[model samples]
Target: MTIYVLIAVMTLALVLLGSSVRVITQFERGVVFRFGRVRPGTRGPGLALIAPVADRLQKVNMQIITQPVPAQDGITRDNVTVRVDAVLYYRVVDPVRVAVDVQDYGSAVLQVAQASLRSIIGKSELDDLLSNRERLNQGLELMIDNPAVGWGVHIDRVEIKDVALPESMKRSMSRQAEAERERRSRVITADGELQASRKLAEAAEVMAEHPAALQLRLLQTVVEVAAEKNSTLVLPFPVELLRFLERATPPETTTAASTAATAPSESAPPTAPARTNGAVPAGRAVYPAAPDAAAVAHAVAER
Candidate 1:
């Protein structure tokens, strides 16, 4: 009967010892509650002892938590509707406040993050959300940290994951991008043409100042064409050469006999004078004999 009583007492002492001793990991802290009231200063790593019946230890993790915020639909400040989502990185700094100040710190942080994200969406434009996400993330972190600091949660960083646009908005942006590219391409082509025109004008001036340069260019063109080994080649004649030849040639003069035949006679009437042996009459004005058709044809052939 004494052995049985001793065994019962030893078993109860072992149970109490097991219940009172708590093990905290290196990344965890023990928040002690004494009779439903939180005690000051949290227990660190290693084994912790407390009164078995009057004390309770809650383990809180100190590791960073990665929480994904769900996509929210809202109208922006510019009156554009969009859907946005994000991710948050945070960790607990004070285990006591995390345990006593909030019923569930994780859930509270999530709720605050969602509310801050929605509020940021309402205050920002679609352009800022797409282009200036870094600024928006800082603002979101600040907003969420204000309420979360009281719960012993510190926001390390916030990142906007995705911003979804409607089909109409997507199409409009695509068209805008295409138009911008086309405008740039046209401007580049126009600039190229302007440069080519200026170079060609300069080349023309150079060739005009040095006539031999034109000849050299023609020779170069001929060489390039010959290098192609083509069966046919077309050569151009310069108009200046033709004008020079025309200027060098002398004008022709008419002979006296031919001129007298072509000019109207001032001394005689329309009727021919009476001739004797192919000679003009004595009183009529004497004129040189007109050249024969054979002689005129010979002169033209000689010319």
Candidate 2:
């Protein structure tokens, strides 16, 4: 019976020894504690032996952890009611503190992240959140990081997943954006109109200088209208031709022209001259009581 009891005691000791032996994986770290107090440092990923009941070890995974912060509702600095949700990425830089410092680091970080989100939302304006998102995200990571560091959680990144705005506020913002776009559109259209008018003025000056571009423009217009299939095309003649003709004409006729006018009238009375000669000859017959043809012929030959 004593031999059987010795065998049972040996069996119990082997089981206890086996129980004290722990194996840690490569991705895990073990924080050792002695009598309810954590040791100064951590343990290994390989085989480790601990005195049962006196030594306690808590294993922590060293992988990067992702924690989601709950949605937080707060009023912005601009008095806008906003609901914001965020995501946090963290990893345990110090495994000992992770096991010893906080009761539950994950829960603590989540709560702190929610609070930090609220605080940031309260501090930032609505436009600041919309326009300066990177700044806000950095600020959030900074604010949440300082406290999380003590909990053995090193915050790598913080992201604002979504920001929920009130329906009324969203509509107001939409209208504001639309109005801004419209204002820009109107300014651009006005600028285009100004440019076009300036170009027209420049072209007018060119036409005034060359006096030919106007004809080209008119010709182009006629071409444009002619392409419309059977449409009547009204052609515009240049006013420069008429102006040139006006400039070339004289106001009065010269003396040479007046003399040339009198020569034609002088030669036009041949019939009258003949009639006067015949009458005179007839009258001379009456006066010829003392004259004959021989006498007239001798007088003509001597004259």
Candidate 3:
């Protein structure tokens, strides 16, 4: 009877010892709760011993945990509706607070991250969400870390994963971008044309001062056109060249040209005078006798 009692007592002690012993991994921390109340400090990695009946050991992972936040729908400050999602990286910094402060740190962090994401989306514009994610991410991290710090969770990083825009908003943005690009192209082309016109005006003034330059340009144009091997070649006659030739003519040649222009052609033709009622009208003949032309003729015949 004494031997059987000793064996029963030894078996009970072995079971208690096994239950009290715990193996903690290097990436985990052991938290102990005694009488339903948390202990002062946490246990580090490795073997831990606790009172089997009064003590409970909870292991909190110290390694970084990646939690994906679900997509949240919200309206932006600009009155644009959008859907946004994110990812959070976190880890337990204080095992005591993690075990005592929050019921489930992982779920708590995930909820906090989602709320923060929605709040950020509401406060920011659509442009900021799409183009300024770095600032938004920093803001999100700060927001999550503020509440998480009390729970013994450290926010390693927070990042916005994707933003879904409405189809109408997307089309509007595309048209706006296209219009801006077209406006820029038109402005650039106008500027180029203005510059080219100014350059052409300056070139024209220079060509006017130098007659030989104009000739050279004409000759160059001719050469270029001739190089195309076209059957028809047209040469431009400049009015300036004609003016230059006119100015260079001799004075005698100019006077003779004026005289020749005034002179009549020698085509032969004789004009005859007409007699009315078988008598010439007075003052009508080319050479008329004095006032009494008939009396003077009759006196000469009587003499």
Candidate 4:
């Protein structure tokens, strides 16, 4: 009986020791509480021992925790209603505080994250939520981290995952975007027209200074049109050709006009004797007096 009692006692002690010893992973920390009060600091990666029945050990993971915040509905500063969801990355920094300061750190962090998200949404506009996520994320991290710091939680990062707007708002945005694109297209087209007009004005100045360029341009246009193998081509008469013709004839015309104005007129003929219709007066026929041959010859020689 004495031998059996000794063996039982030894077995009970071994079992209690085994129960008190804990193997903590590298990514975890143990928070020890003695007599309902949290002990200082934290227990580490390998083995942790606690007093049986008089102490408690709570294992807190030190690894980064990825918690997805559910979609939250809120009105923005611009009075736009939207739903926003996010992802939170955090970890327990101080296990003693995490275990002692907060009843449930995970739940508290989640609540803080949700509240921070809603507050940020209320402070920002819809445009910022959609286009300025980086800023919003930083703000959210700060907001949540400030409250969570007291509970020994460190916010690694916060990211907005999705934002949903109303159907009408989406349609309105689509129309606005379309209008903006149309305005840009019209501006570009007008700019092109303005540039083309300036170039054409420059070309006109160049062509006016050099008339031969007009002829060459005309010929080039004809060639280009002909290359299309069209059956009918309407060729326009160049005004330059008319100008050339007028310049070529002016000198000769001026000389002829001057000569005609200086020449003397021929003398009038003497009237023949009155005669009956179809009857000839039988006598020597009187003739008209002609201009002097010497005067006519002098005028011709001067011309």
TM-score for each model? 0.79, 0.73, 0.75, 0.78
- Which 10-residue span in candidate 2 carries the lowest summed lDDT? 287-296
Q: Which structure among the candidates has the greatest lDDT?
A: 1
lDDT of 1 by residue, 1-303 (tens): 999999999999999999999999999999999999998988999999999999999999999999999899889999889999999999999999999889999999999999999999999999999999999999999999999999999999999999999999999999999999999999999999999999999999999999889888977887888879864554443435544654544443545556778877778668764668977667678655443444444554575
Best by TM-score: 1
lDDT minimum window of 10 residues, candidate 1: 289-298
Ranking by lDDT: 1, 3, 4, 2
lDDT per residue for candidate 4 within 1-303, as digits (tens), equals 999999999999999998799889999999888899888878889989999777888899899999999999999999999999999999988888887788999899999999999999999999999999999999999999998999999999999999999999999999999999999999999999999999999999999999889889988887888878864555444455456545544365777898899766668556555877977668756565434444444554575
* Each model's backbone clash number: 0, 0, 0, 0
Candidate 1 regions off by >4 Å?
222-229, 234-303
Please give the lDDT score at residue 73 for candidate 2.
91
For candidate 3, the TM-score is 0.75
Estimate candidate 3's alpha-carbon lDDT, on a 0 to 1 scale. 0.88
Looking at candidate 2, what is the lDDT of residue 228?
68
Question: Can you rank all candidates by TM-score, best first?
Answer: 1, 4, 3, 2
